[model samples]
Target: MECAAKGLAGEPCAGVAQRRCGSCGAVAYCSKDHQFVHWRFHKEECARLATQMSRIDVLSQFPFTFSVEPLALNHTLPSMRCLFLESIKVHLKGLWKPECICGPEIASVKDLSITAEWNMESSLCPCTEPENPVTRPLASWEDYYQWRSLPLHSPVAVLLHWPLTLYHCLQLSRIQTSRHDGHATLNIHYLGPEKELLQLAVFAELLALFPGVHLRIELVGPAVPRSRDGEVVNISSYAHCSVQNCGCRSSTAPEDLNSSAVTLKLWKGLYHERYSDIAKDSNPHLVLAPNAGVAAYPSWMPTIEMIREIGIPAIFTDFCEEAAHLASCCISYITGQPLGVPIQINPFRQPIAENNSALYIPCYSNCFVFGM
Candidate 1:
């Protein structure tokens, strides 16, 4: 771990952090002097961090096999990056590059839209309403798996976070789920989608989560390919395992495209740049940004301002408490108001820890969530 203290030049100290804070255990220092030097800034979050760390058991619970491993023991394992690569059967040598080092031109965007060639027929469809649908809140991955009748060993650990995070946001917002006429409709604006573009099928779980609610999610982000801009994906059925004897597939036929339960629209630009056009079609009831590095990205300022002006309830998740705190500060600064929703541990956060974090904090995808 790296020291949280700053050096004389106002940069993060380049010393090894072996001394962890006793109260919070979320930050570390190289020495007592450095700890004393950082106390002024760290004092603000010490108690909050301590409170969060106290509930480590609940926060760390997940159904994934790797969930049993302690995040603090990250040093013992080969790295989260290596684990992920092994899970997906990708080579570690030159095959994987977490971040793009080359210019944008070399990283050409591919068509991320779903097509008929995907062979949706081979996949199980959990489209029909269950004989006894789940009405209670699902508090954990195990809860969801039990409700959905999914085996614990299902290979959905990584991609399930997207839909689970969305569900958590909806729960935190307390959005009305009552049906009207025949079905209720919920519109969500998903900002800054990246890898999610390739795994949209996983979101079909929302159909099962909100039984009678029709979901329309508009994915707006720079990561959307230009070719797929304005493209619409209609998920008429929930995605299920293709295993022959899984026993969770629905017998009902797929619904017509026009009457799909979940619909996704893609936009290929920053949220603020295209919010006008997007809102003209359908105003969102809630906005979601998973792993949004609000403090690190200046472009988020415009989006924050727009969300505030429009008075939309927007939720954001960050990798760690420090990041969430910084993001909360950024949102407060941009909106000139205190956060409407305070940061808390996301129950459905990805079980895998992030390996690149410099601090001793338990960093994971969608680790902490807050709203404005």
Candidate 2:
């Protein structure tokens, strides 16, 4: 005999009395196919019964009454008494909430009162010009409702694979499930001219999915003129941002290589002094100098001819404009342990103090440390 749930060869285990559970014998299985293939019949029932059996299992450990069915199934059971007694109804929804269960709404932030009204004016970064810095402040504790346990929204879930579930939790936290009513509209502000407003709006919708972020879209200045092809012609014609473009997805290589790795060759240059211990085959990470002296080097300082001699596949990106494209390409390939290598001097600089943890490669001066 074997346990259907554990799939371990052993004595027959019964879950629902004579019925054995298809996945785990803690319950019942109608047939092998039903045990493995049919889920529509078992999912909700299993969750409900699992709650009951688990209660029975726990109570059996104590001197309390043997009957745990009421404890498990009752909406007003001991475990749920306080939650039900409370006047406020707590709800969960979105990626985090299943069925968008409605519950009490709670204020998430605190309120501070000013003794009196006063205003101060100061010239600040245009980014700091928003009239209201904080929106959606918590109103009161009356808004909160307690959750009983994890909600069942998906058909299949595993416990040991908690990382997958935890990531889901993080994403679900962003959904204001209680505000599912069509009336709840969020105002967004984008600091650009009218021409670029459409693109910014789409980006903001995506950003809203990030937790702890709220954006208010406001167009800062007049609209910029555009060419017939919908391209902005003048770069500096307006004050608010115009025609902003990024190399985040741009590539110089063929389209097929977008998903593959590219080899990197390390050329020796003024950065050579720092590479003394680093094997020519393995490019050394860089360190930036501080006010200690003139430390700025061209992005191509690492692209010397000697690097290509190593016979490793590599790409050449000397211009700052190309850094984003290069980084995107390399990162996409290195999703897991990758075979190829990439060398670039455009490593962002870390504060000098943070570099204390790593054996510091020498720098031309003292202000910054280049990271690999």
* lDDT at residue 268 of model 2 (Cα atoms): 22
Candidate 2, number of clashes? 36
**Model 1 residue pairs with clashes:** none
Instruction: Please give, for residues 235-274, the per-residue lDDT of candidate 2 as tens digits.
Output: 1000121112322113132333212211112122233332
After TM-score superposition, what is the CA distance of residue 199 in candidate 1 from its true location, in Å? 1.2
TM-score of each: 0.76, 0.15
User: Evaluated with TM-score, which candidate comes out highest?
Assistant: 1
What are the per-model C-alpha RMSD values against the true structure? 5.5, 25.1
TM-score of 2: 0.15
